[model samples]
Target chain A: MIIDGLINGIALGCIYALVALGFVLIYKATHVINFAQGEIMMFCSYICYAGSTTFHFNFILSFFFAVIAGFLLGALLERLFIRPLIGYPILPVVIATIGIAMVLQSVAALIWTFEPQKLDPFSGSPYQLWKVSISPVHLWTIIITFILIFLFSLFFRHSLVGIKLRAIAEDLIGSMASGIPVRRMYNFTWGLAGAIGAVAGILVAPVIFIHPHMGSIGLRALPAAVLGSFGSIPGAVVGGIVLGVSETIAGLYLPKEIKDVFPWLLLFLVLLIRPEGIFYTYEQKKV
Target chain B: MKKIKVLAIVGLCVACFLSFTSNTIADTGVNKKVILVGGSLDLTGPAAFMGQGVKRGINLYFNKVNAEGGIHGRKLKYIAEDDGYVVAKTVSNYKKLTLKSRVFCLLGSTGSVGPKALKPYLEEDKIPLVGPYGYTSAMFRPFHTYLFNIYATCEDQAKIFVDYLKTELKLENPVIGLLAEDNEIGQDTIRGAEAQVKKVGWQAPVVELYKRSAIDFSSQVLRLKAKNVDALFFPVISSHSAQILKECQKANFQPLLFATATATDLRFLKMAGDSAYFGKGLRSFATQINHRDNSSGAEEFRAAIAKYDPSNKDPNSFNLFGYGIAKILCEGLQQAGADLTREKLISALEKMDGYETGIFAPMTYGPNNRQGTDSVRILRADHNKKDFVIETGWLHPE
Candidate 1:
């Protein structure tokens, strides 16, 4: 039972990691934490659901179509809402993202009524691994997370556009001085983050079922990103895993009420000791 | 001088129109021929189904009554404002429904917390609000003069589940376990379970609390399996119910699963799909009759909804609840008689005894007892039909 709980927690954490990647990517490129990342995830999943159900597209085909739709959505949102506040402070941009969140939330509600409906492009059957049951959705979530992580790691290391996105993250003005298309990179990062959110949403829909407020899963992602030191990508995965594992352990050993609070308590204690987070990278200045 | 004379003539005509209509339009919503009622429903929130369904039920009953020439020559109009299931919005909706609509009474709203928030205001104004979705015990426990209840509360539903297990299942010592959500309804259900468990001389049951937003229930299922409980009672939303069903199947933890009225819908089965096969042995406690039961009352409800509320021909728990409450309100009006007043209506409601609402158990009320009924019918999950089948008649707990 304990082992089963541990496995389940890791699968749950992988979902958080996927969502945290969206937050981390957006913050990395534009230095603005999009409050609407969760809603973006929810809306994209709805698009995926609509494509498969309404347009009669195959399940996997609709997923890829939704990913592209999500990319374009992120790019469009950046061009329309976020781009205007480029020269402005972070607070205004964050506020603008919140406004977009509200708009997106209502749009989803208007499109799909408030009633929660099932989305099962993925089945709920689990495979038995050494007497431990693992649901297919959870397995897919973990597999997709690892693949995206490996791909993102390579992109950041070797890809030219990835390097430009990183340069923009480091300092927008300096990147532009070096003739890097900083604005274009910011828009590109938003689209990339949006695509990441779509994957997370698609994986999550089978488990939670899709609703307008399902984007609230992003609430946990915000903390995951914060616990991962806000700047480091790998930190997000580690932080999410720790949060998930501890919650399951608490549910198994401690009182049930303690399970929900256990992750936040751990995050609190960690912040108290290491304000810079577990995987902090301090930047050195050149004179 | 000519323009001034014309303006004076127009002003006098307006004043005379107001004076002529003033007698019929009083401060109270009741006029010579119309009785206005209002509701602050969660039309667009997580519980929107409840609000929307109940509204249909209310309208169905009212439409039938209106077609038959209304209660005591007064036409009934129910105006509902969408609160989106938010408490603050429910409060604001309460204000708009009360002040702007000038409703004679307030009818069905969703969620306990929203009604609880509006309780103080309803009390201050001494306004009567009737037949809210039975989620709170606070309404009738203290016997608030203004709030009239028709069906069993969440606590009653929980106790009924336990009582059914003891009496029908013949468990000499029922080892009931609970999977409670971390919300007010969850706590209320736990309290009722504890009461029933103690009554039957059972040991303190194992309790598991899950978060409201928790989509995954594998850990909870693993915990339930570890306990090896005789029965697992979980009162949660439809999706949560469906998710728990799927997870329990995956884990192969087949305890006698019990759910509250919230899970009494095809929505759960539709969401659970093939996974709902695990719930073949499931039992549920609900206040009203299932639409598929095809009882006389259910038939009448279906016919009425089809005739009146054509859009919602298919009835669910929410619509059933509305129909029950609307019938009760109409009775109160009839009992109040030709000289209708709020106080008289309250007196009439208090005097209600064994009043059958056609869809639910007979309700009895008193001056001190505001609760209408503490009874429910048991239903068994039928996977083949993909719906709940009525297994027993109404059972009332002490």
Candidate 2:
């Protein structure tokens, strides 16, 4: 049972990692939180479902269409909503994202209806490793999350645009003065975050199924973001895995009602003990 | 200017007097033209789909009734408020609907927690709550005068599931297990299962309750497998049921699964996907008859929704429940003879004995008994047909 829990925990942690990457990407680039990350993920998943079911696209084609849709949606949302609030109070921009989340959810429900729709997993068969059984979806989620993380590390460290995004995140005015298109950077940040979240949603949908409100699961990833110090890309992945394993092991020992509380409890402890998070170095911000 | 101001003030006072005195004119949402009823539903919550389906079902019946000149010249108007499945929100909606809107009664308040929270206010106000969609045992045991339930308690369904396995399936000393939600509904099922375990001399079932949001059921399934449980009693919604069943199949653990009505929805099949094979032949205690049952109620519901609620061409279990509740409520109102009061409606509802709601079996309620039905039919999930098949006629708990 513990082994099974460990496997499942890792699988769930990978999903939370992908979602945390959504938060990390937007915050790391723009220094503004996108509260609508979950809704964007949900919308893109529905697009994938529609692509497969309505448009008769194959799974790969469906995924491609979803990622493109997610990118466009993020770009459009940033252009329409976030750009206006640039250089304003961070709190209001955050508040505006919450509004965007609500609007996006309502729009998704209107388009797709608020029912749990099914998406076929890419490939899955119960496989055994060392006499312990693991689900195909869980295994695939881990594989995809790691691949994305590897690609992300290379993109951030080696790619020119990646350094530009880092520069924008560190000093927005400095980047703008240094000839980096600040508005374009913001749009790219939001778009990339949306695309990353779409991957997570599409992968997780096969396991939990798809619904407009399924995006609420994205909220669980918030603790992962916090644990990863909210800004560190690698921190999101590591923090997510730790939180997932903590919950699973907690379930093994604690009563079921108390088990779900483990994630929030961990979040509190992290904040109380090391608010900088496991993978982050705290730096003072100047006004 | 002063004279005009005095006239404006007099006009404002007159308007206030007319609005405040309007209750007497309508007699608390009842009038010669319309009767305003209310529903505190989870129309925009986690269970929003269920709430919307039920609301559509009820609206189908109401729109049909209204088109046919209504119940004795008074049109039934159902105003639903979205409570988001929160207890406090349900209470707030109920209070606003009753105190401000002066709605006559509440139909199909969404979840057990919401209804359980409203018990005190219900007792205090004495507003007859007809067809509340919940399965709390407290509603039945220490029965509230105003809260009239539409279905058997979760405990009743649990007992029926166990009894069916014992007698009909003939499982001699079966090892039963419970995978339930951490809520009153889950507790009720556990209560019934525990009682049966003691009665039949079966070993105590390895029980585990999960948070409503917790989708991972691998550990629970593995735990059940380790215990060698022959049967698992489930009291959860369809989405969670699909996830759990798939997890069980992935682990190669198959047990005789018996779920409540909520888990037996056709929606589960769609959600279970290729993993739907695991749900094959799974059983559940059904509240309303299957849409494919070819019964009069099924036919009527189909025809009604087709004409009145065309959007809901394929109504699920929630829709049927709403249709049944509306049917019963309408009958009681008709029996009340157009002169409806809280007391009168309560008396009329209490007098129901073997009253057919077209969807459910004859539901009888007495002064001491407020439950709509104590019987449920057994349904088997048929993945091949992608629908639920009725396995047995209506059977009560032994």
Candidate 3:
């Protein structure tokens, strides 16, 4: 029973982790909490649906194009909406993001006309392990999520572009004084965040049915981001797994009525104890 | 401000006079032109699919009736608005339809939560609300005279399935378990299933509830596995149904799965991959017209939608539901015979008994029986089941 719980926890955790990673990516770069990250991810999945189902593109090709589409959408949103409000009061920026989310949702509704779409980009079906079973979709989510995380780490650590983004994130004025193009980096951050959201959306779609409302799963992953220290990349991963597994196990063994509160309970406990997150350094901001 | 108010009053009077004149002209030709049925829909929310489908169903039926010279020289006019599936918006939209649009009756208003919110207003206004998309006894309790429930209650529907498994399919000593959402709708199913189990000479079945947005049900399935249930009833929506089915298949718990009408979607089948079609459930109503059917009514609905808005082709079940209820409203209006007022039309509907209109079952309504479509038929499907097969003839709940 314990082993089964762990396996289920890890598998479910990975998806939440993927969502958290997207959240962390944007927050680290922009200090802007994108309330619409999940919707952006959900929109990407719909784009994938349009690519393969409506446009009849090849699966891999559709996925590649979806990533590109996510990047472009993110970059454009940053340039047009997020850039002008760079130094504005936080409320308007937050509200602007919310408006952007609404516009995107309305556009999706107009295009799709509110019907659930089934997407299976993978070729094979679910394969069984001893006493436990796993789907190719879930397995793909784990593998792809890890690969993306690894690639993101390598890019940030080794690439010149990555250094520029880090410089901007750490000190926007200092990065500007150092001749780094801060405006371009902001657009890049949005694009990267969009890409991450898209991948998360594609992974989530096959597991559950795809619809405009499936964006709530991304919002649920917000706790995953918060519980893992909002700014820490690795923290997001660990936090998501813990929350996912705990919730699933609680849904079974715990009082069934309170199972929905699993994520919140775990989040509260984590916050009370290790306020910076399970993995992050607790740096007190000197006001 | 004074000048604006005077101008506004004059403008209002002029608009009213023009409308009155045109309506008089229409009256001179045919008298009662058409009874307009309108609805406030949650076309962009969690229940958007249902809202969209119900509306499509109503439009399809209305088009057919309008083509046949309508009922008593009156064509059925349907107007719909997106309520965002929110209660505030639904209530506001209801007011707009009644006060501004002046619709005759509400044809198949959608949503359990939205309708629940609008319940008091609907009753107070005495607007005949026909065939709301979703069913709960709470909808029927305190019995609003203006409203007629077109679908069977979840309890009645669940009983139909349980009775079939016991009497017809003859599954012996069936150890059943219920998997439902943790919401009121899910709770309603659990209640219905428990009632059915007790009534059917069986012990109460194992019941488990999950949140509406849960991504997994493996743990719940595993617990039922320990119980070795003979069959499991998953009274859930399409998305949850897909998740539960995939998890059940993974767990190798091959119990006969039973689901509610909400699980009846092509999307559910597609998401379940190869094992999509392996289940039996009850649907409140089926489209009397489909892509295959060549009914003239279906053609007319298609044409109307094509003429107005050609883009939305894949009409959801709610659309057909709307179509069916509109037909019933037209039936009531036609039966009212002339002197068309709300009271006359309602009285005409009240006197109805076992009235079949091709699409829906024979409905009987009096002061006592405001509920419509009490007749439900058991439907079965296997892995390769092309369409849901009607296992038993239509049976009315006692």
Q: Of the candidates shown, which would achieve the greatest TM-score relative to the real structure?
A: 1
How does each model score on TM-score? 0.94, 0.90, 0.89
lDDT, candidate 1, B1-398, per-residue tens: 99999999999999999877853545567877889888989888878877888888898899899999999988898999999888999899888877887888888878777777888898988888888776658777676888887768768877877777778787766567788788777777888888988888877777777877676677778887887777888888778887887778777678888877777778777787767667436777777888766788888888887788787645677888888888999999889997888889889998999998778788888888878888888787787787888888898875
For every model in order, the fraction of real contacts preserved is 0.67, 0.51, 0.51
lDDT of each: 0.83, 0.84, 0.74
lDDT of 3 by residue, A202-228 (tens): 988877767777777777898889988
- CA error at residue A178 for candidate 3, angstroms: 3.0
Candidate 3 lDDT over residue span B205-309, tens digit each: 888887766777767877787788777777676677777777666555677777666555455555666644433322322313332235454565556567644
Worst 10 residues of 2 chain B by lDDT: B272-281
Top lDDT model: 2
Evaluate residue A255 in candidate 3 and report its C-alpha lDDT on the 0 to 100 scale.
86
Error of 3 at A255 (Å): 1.3
Model 2 residue B211 CA deviation (Å) reads: 1.6
Per-residue CA lDDT of candidate 2, range B1-398, in tens? 99999999999999999777653526467877778889999888778888998888889889989999998888898999999888889989988999888898888867777877888888888887888887777776787888888788888888888889888999888888899888888889889888977788877778988987785777677778888888887878778888877887777777887777776666776676555456334787888787766899989888887888777656788888888899889988888887777788888888999998768868899988887787888888776787778899888888
lDDT of 1 at B369: 82
Off by over 4 Å in 3: A1-5, A123-125, A282-287, B1-31, B265-267, B278-316, B396-398
lDDT per residue for candidate 1 within A117-218, as digits (tens), equals 677865856788888887777777788889989999999999999888888888888998999987788889889989988988898888888888998888
